[model samples]
Target chain A: MFHLIKKDLIIQKHLLLLYLIMLTIFIYFQNSSVFIIVLISAIMTLNSFYYDDFFNAHKLMNALPFTRKELVSAKFIGIIVFTSATMIVFMIVSSILNGGIVLLAWQWIVFSLALAMFYGALYIPLIYKLANQNLISIFLFIYVVTAILIPSILDYINEYFPNIILFFYHLPDSQLYSLLLLISVIFYLLSWRLSIKIYEEKEL
Target chain B: MSNILEVDGLRKVYAKSQFVLKDIDFSIPYGSIVGFIGENGAGKTTTMGAILGTLKKDRGAITIFGKKVDVTKPKIREDIGVVFDDMNFSSHLNVDQLAKVMKNIYQQWDNDKYNHYIQLFSLPKKQKIAGFSRGMSMKLSIAVALSHGAKLLILDEATAGLDPVARDDILEVFIDFVKDKDHAIFLSSHITSDIEKIADELIFIKNGEIILKVNKDELLHNYAIVQCRSDTFHEINEDDVLAYITKDEMLNVLVSNKHGLPRGCQISDFTIDDITLLLMKGENNERTHS
Candidate 1:
């Protein structure tokens, strides 16, 4: 399974390089906002996996003797591995450009986690039902809509209950980090399970 | 010989009026290479997909080696290998990368055999699959299928577009596959001459229905085209005839038993193609009459 994941990553190395260059260029001129780069990086990383299967990679996955569960597991694991790598690179670049140990905001953390969770959730069903043929248009539509709606919703919430923002802002750094981490872990696991179930019923 | 694979009451009804396959039943022995012959829309590919559990069936049962198939269980797939006409390999991966990926997929994968077939087929190991020609891609697929020690192989139009040489090379590989008495193959193709060269049994399907299934030797000895006037052809009993095609003056009847043909009828050898065409026509005639 690890080898399968490694092989998949190797196949998409060029895409990764292109994404890194594009993100680096997008961040260079703008004021160093770690949140923006990290958010975009995470979304791009996750979307790469989605696009591959959405386009033409499905038959390759199916023709292998692997179970749908193994394929699903490998994909989920690949996303995690890819996302962690992308996050590390993003942090390194942001710190170099900002000239300090600039940390990610809790909002940034929450936003990234939610995006990843939602990506996996929506991608699983769409892929199972539509295959990869319509992956781009649907993924773009969802990504744009979510990108627009999420920040607006967060802003509205901040306005309605200023204390809610203060509470998250003032919570002990370690406790807040742990809570977000726990939620992220739970969402990832749930996404993995849901993807497996949907893939099992998908016609080849 | 015991049946190595059995499919009973197999049916797949798609949306609209499409019946991709309906009531398909057949069995093959442990070592037989059975040729599944049909036209473009005759559901040959669909049946193979159903047997492999890749396509959904409305209702049916498929068993291999006397064991029931559980589609959710990947272990059932370990015993079989499939090669489709279209390339299923991801274009980005090189042959070496693909081999490593496949090693983890099939527990019975033989690296030595895989490499041997790759070399034998003369496929470039370092090139991406997308860069290869159609014939090369098919050769790679055949290599992957054979690399795993699968007892049964299912090929869908595996020889459709190849030049004669490439097709012959594939045929040679298939001949070697069934050399061991424990192996069997379900080869679906429109190329009847290729089928004639390699298959031990022939299954003729037309318009989503199986019209005939018989051993190659029996089919060869029994099937004959009886040519006579269209009016005289009606004198033969419908029960004895498998299929009949009518031209302006000649009525070519495909009979299961040549011995039962009328004495005045002229008999000629029937190739697999002839049999398939006659059956297809007969099926349309049956629909027209009904």
Candidate 2:
């Protein structure tokens, strides 16, 4: 599994360099750091699938000694490794730029990690089931719907669910972090299982 | 002789397609190369895929190394090396980088052997595989397949895009691989001459069915192509005839046994290419006679 991860990373080495440059700009600008981190993480992690599809490497992989379950596990593990490494890099750069670690930097790091976990949890299973082409279409569809719905949804929540929003807003940092970690772990595990099931039956 | 791979009653059907592999059966004995000969869309690749567990078989059993295959187990695949006609490695990776990736993937990957093949095939070490010509890519694939200490090699058209010199070199490598008593190769190719040169057994498939499987020596010694008039051809027993083609008022017939052929029936020497052409282009004796 680690070998498979290494192959994915090596294939996307150029993309990683591009992500590093983008990440530096995002850190220096300090605008939408969380979003940028999540975006970079998603692209770097998903780049493996792109290379696999482009080269038809999946057929070779399936023919190798690794099982479909192991292949899926390796993808999840690669995402986690990539997200964690990028988060660490961003945190260090942010601290360096600000002269020291601060509360805002810590908050952004935690939020980015949470978002990375959520994205991996959501996308991995989708990629496994729908594969490359269909997954991209579904992502586009969701992006459009989310863009059109966010404002109205926020208004509705602010009007009728004010207390719920307040409850989260006022939650202790430790409690919020714990909640995010718990949810992330649960979603990731479920996604791994779902991906394994989907890939086992998939025809190469 | 002990068999390294055995495929029995294999069957597959693609959704919304009429093509189906019907009860395919063949075996590759240890220390021998079994050649798979077939025309396009004749289920050669499908059969190979089924044996490798890449394609789901509707019904069949594939036994490798004396045990029923369980593709979900990584250990089972550790002993098999496969090369398809289409290159499967990432184009972004160079040969050296690919070696690194393969090193981690195969437990018995021999870096020395890989480098040797690289030198032997004259492939550029630093150039990305995307820039490689078809023959170069094919050589790289074969090199990777051989570097791993796989006891069985399954190759589909591994020599498709090579010059005669390069093809000869690769064929020699295959011969060297199976020199050990425990190693074997199952290869499919349109180049019947290559098969004729190295194969110990030959399997002919047509339209998703195995029409003939015979030892190479037996095939060469027992099978004869007889040229005669249509009247004399009709007199020959249909059971002894395999396939025939009629041209210019002469019938060229492929017969399994040449002994006691009718008088004036011209028995001629036949090559693997000749047999392949007849098997593919000519009508089966049963069909024609009926």
Best by DockQ: 2
State the lDDT of candidate 2 residue by residue for B56-140, as single tens digits.
8999999999999887776778789999997568888899999989998999999999999999999999999989999999999
Q: Best candidate, TM-score-wise?
A: 2
> Against the true structure, what is model 1's DockQ?
0.42
Q: List the candidate 2 regions with Cα displacement exceeding 4 Å.
A: A99-110, A134-156, B285-290
lDDT values of the candidates? 0.74, 0.84
Off by over 4 Å in 1: A1-4, A19-60, A89-115, A132-134, A137-156, A160-163, A174-194, B283-290
> Cα deviation of B114 in candidate 1 (Å)?
2.3
Would candidate 2 be rated incorrect, acceptable, medium or high by CAPRI criteria?
Answer: medium
DockQ scores of all models, one per candidate: 0.42, 0.69
Clashing pairs in 2: none
